[model samples]
Target chain A: MTIKRKILAAILALALPLASPVLASEQAVTFVQNNVSKVLQVLSDPALGDVQKGKLFSEVITQVTDVDVIARFVLGQYAATASTPEFERFARVFRGYALGVYQSELSRFGNEVLEVQSVQERKPGDSVVLTRISGGALSKKSRDVKWRVITIKGTPRVVDIEISGVWLSQHQRAEITGIITKNGGQISAATKMLCSQSKTCTVTG
Target chain B: MALAGCVHPPWRAKSDPLEPMNRAVFAFNTVADKTVLKPIAKTYQTITPKPARKGVRNFLDNLQSPVVFVNDVLQGKPKRAAKTLARFAINTTVGVGGILDVAKAAGIEKHYEDLGQTLAHHGVPSGPYLVLPLFGPSNVRDLAGLGTELAVSPLSFTRFKGKQTFGRVRLALNTMDRRVETLQEMKTIRKNTLDEYVSIRSYYQQLRKDAIADGVVDMDELPDFDLIE
Candidate 1:
């Protein structure tokens, strides 16, 4: 290759990666912003029944959230030890539980609007997007909501959320691990308990 | 960066030196909650109508207003102190001894403050985290704060017949009220978390920090990051 071309290639290699993080950060912010707007719309739609709102919520949650990652993280040590089928079953139920949680919580803020405030890229692939929820009966002033987004295979997905300073996935990890430990380290026990509590999942034998 | 990845947050390591002892106490607390507290809270919920429950909570909250006001003054939050004072006066009178939250209806929202938050506002560091037998999660700083509050509690000094009995009843009702309010959340936590102790500790620390900042997230406390120019 020509000397000029070689130098140009070297500059491109350094600059391209540097530029990618900025782009990824913007992408993360936009991802959260759009999804949050969608959630607010679903919540406020007067014509939609509760079941319809729930269905839309589940769809958005499945698309925007990395439920597989969250399920594994909440499972903790058991994620590595459990059988593949067992892990999958747990993940399936976790999805329903997560959907239920998001739906119920968001329903309370039906009149609120969440506006993206700022974005901070922690690393090349991870970003924290801060948003504010205000103008609702529930939140008379405003509340801070932080979303941790991680790019997975070129698509940004939410990995965790910090609302009122409590990280959802971290809290879930503690809860799931506690249940598993309480029931003699049985994964099935945790699944059965969550199934009963959420009433959104079924434990199949 | 690699070292940072391995290093836990300051709150995780510095605040929880008594993990073993705390875990034991937490277990005892959990058993007590399951066997005694939960049952009582459930019964209370079952028997008490929603309005009655709200009245109980309001009355309890009104009783704590003096402590909250004092702490707000100590923390140099005059606005919050004034609000606390107003809530107390209004609720005690027009609300008929705090059975109704007239102050809240009049746009004066209730806020909580304690000596621990005052100490925090004054830059006192939260020391080791401890799980009390029935109290659940706390830290060294907060435990000291609790001690101070108890020592100077208005209820303790009230000159009235049956004051001692009232205090005991208040304590019992307070415990039951808290348990009742958090019953569903607690059940979900019990069924969900892998480490209840760690979860509760994290929650306690975050909540304390939030309370100290009056629900405002101190930007400095958040993980440092650079904004894209």
Candidate 2:
């Protein structure tokens, strides 16, 4: 209620919104950086066998990725119509398939180091972090990778990724929805086909 | 859910009506790539220096510039057409017969325009996807465009000593360069995707869409990534 205190409060209020996005962007960068390092560590651990490395990789993927959001997005219009149980089954298979994908991709860069280059905040809690992977295994050239991270209820999670200009989730959406449409709009049929083909997921009913 | 108003999305319009035949061809191409082309490309990558490989790529791209320039004009992009011309002239001379992309160094960045994009610009529908043996994924419109380009290209008519041999060498180098460039990417796709055929189809369509639009992605087609729950 003093004049100086009132002015100080107004200044703080004005600066909070401006500062929050910067903080969120920084957090998003750190989130991706830490996860990338963890993945690299798991990959390079000589003591860990293939199965152990896979389990660790799956854990890291589950920890950092918003699998539910990705599942719904890739499922497209079918997500709106499917029963909760059916959608849950689809999401389960999708999560496994996605984990396999991330594992296969990350395993290829066994000895590379990922360094966060910059972050672009798209909205209040969403940011795109650009990183480069080079050195160690990648002897010839470095590769640029982009991670799309979003904060949900104070936790940052990765929603998508772009490698070599191809967005992985976007590509999946097109392919999965195409499969559903090809199967005459049968989500179950699409699920069965994807599960069978992936070999990484189990089909229930 | 009401079924009356539901319709397939536009991206879904890129259908593959010839799935069985396409899959057969795809299998053949995959085998050919694994057995023959991949080994040759890998060996080429191992033996050839990076700069030499880059020079070959630059030279191949330069050879296609005339065709790209024609397509740019056909697509009503005069600025791009001019750039193509400028790039050809600069690279052919200062870049040592297009072995180096001096034009790119001078800030005239490269942009690809093909007859397929020109037809798409003129509102021709991309018919059902077709997988060509050895050539990989293409649509009816793009396949036609390829034929047209081959017929109209000046290189097709140029006369020189050992012209037939030179043409074969060029084709071989182009194919090898493409395989070398995509070796890791192809492996990733094969290892990751649920269905290799479907994945390749989706990637090919999206890549063509981007090319037709001159690399400007349609934001509306992109998934919403801002889940704040």
Candidate 3:
């Protein structure tokens, strides 16, 4: 092939893959533009209440999301050791837990805004990507809510969620695993405790 | 903060929690990457056209003196290649608009375009999505490529140059500019995507897998829809 053809081939080849994602987003973007406002309005309305917010959560974003997919990510390394029964039980417990987490999060979405601050960034292990999400919280006065979000595979599935400087998930995981290790070093008991960590967020899909 | 509430659907993440989104997002990302960003980058490349300066190549290549010097020491060709490219890139980038022409003129080119793109073209898959701070959309293998670039690139050797503050600043400025460009892209991207978190994760994985497969892994190319969450 000629130099031009090679260059063209290279360009087209790279172009094809990158473009597919960007263009596909156009439809997604259109959807957001059309529906995001209404969705936000419903979520933000004081009169809408938790019941209404819950409805919008499922009707809009939840429907499109495969929450089960996200739950698996949050489980992290534990998935490997989990038996079929353990895995199924954990998935069930965690799913409702995840939705409850998001619904409340979504209800409070525009209430307290995030202001960008300096970042403490590091790309973690090859399988998991860890980003220390730091920012200021804007309610009436601007206080900071510095947190770390570990995105596994692409989704910002919070692995070690931090509030201020406190590492919530890491501490929780350590405590549970520590207990399990203290007991008999079995993975199952530790996972059970981890599954029931947040009672409110625990749902069965 | 994973506050005090979460009621995710049953059987989420299939015991993994991150895999399903990883898969869905990759599937979504595959379409956008191939269909949009890649083409835009190409057009941008054509219209902007970078041409390398004469001695700039040697100066740039000479700057890679440490790269060749070290890689020869390290016994790894990929590291050596990365160091050479990053050094060239940092130089051209800091040399005013010197980058485009030089990259166009030859000292440095989009190596991923030449090698990675070809592999991707033949059906290679990107493994998973990764969201790097200040730099969006990369994967495990690519980041390793980047870490190697950062670790040994000749410009990084300037602190060792003993009397070259200007060279150090030039490299720093280049790094800063790249970070800024990436952040700008992320700001826009945060607003795009059908599912921001999911899309980003999935596409990144797809890209990584594609790179690893030496660029060939044929699979179902799912068409777009109104309900891709």
Winner by TM-score: 2
User: Candidate 3 - CAPRI tier?
Assistant: incorrect
Each candidate's fnat = 0.23, 0.23, 0.00
DockQ of each: 0.15, 0.22, 0.02
Mark the regions of model 1 whose C-alpha exceeds 4 Å error after superposition.
A1-33, A39-59, A62-159, A169-205, B1-14, B224-229
Assess chain B of each prediction and give its TM-score.
Answer: 0.90, 0.90, 0.37
Taking all chains together, the TM-score of candidate 3 against the true structure is: 0.31
Model 2: runs farther than 4 Å from truth?
A1-23, A117-122, A197-202, B1-58, B65-130, B140-148, B209-221, B225-229
Off by over 4 Å in 3: A1-7, A13-43, A55-61, A103-108, A111-205, B1-229
TM-scores, each model vs. reference: 0.68, 0.74, 0.31
Which lDDT tens digits does candidate 2 get at residues B54-90?
A: 9999999999999999999998899999999999999
Instruction: Give the candidate order by descending DockQ.
Output: 2, 1, 3
| Alpha-carbon deviation at B201 in model 1, angstroms | 2.0
Using lDDT as the yardstick, the better of models 1 and 3 is 1
Q: Which candidate tops DockQ? A: 2
Local lDDT at B9 for model 3? 35
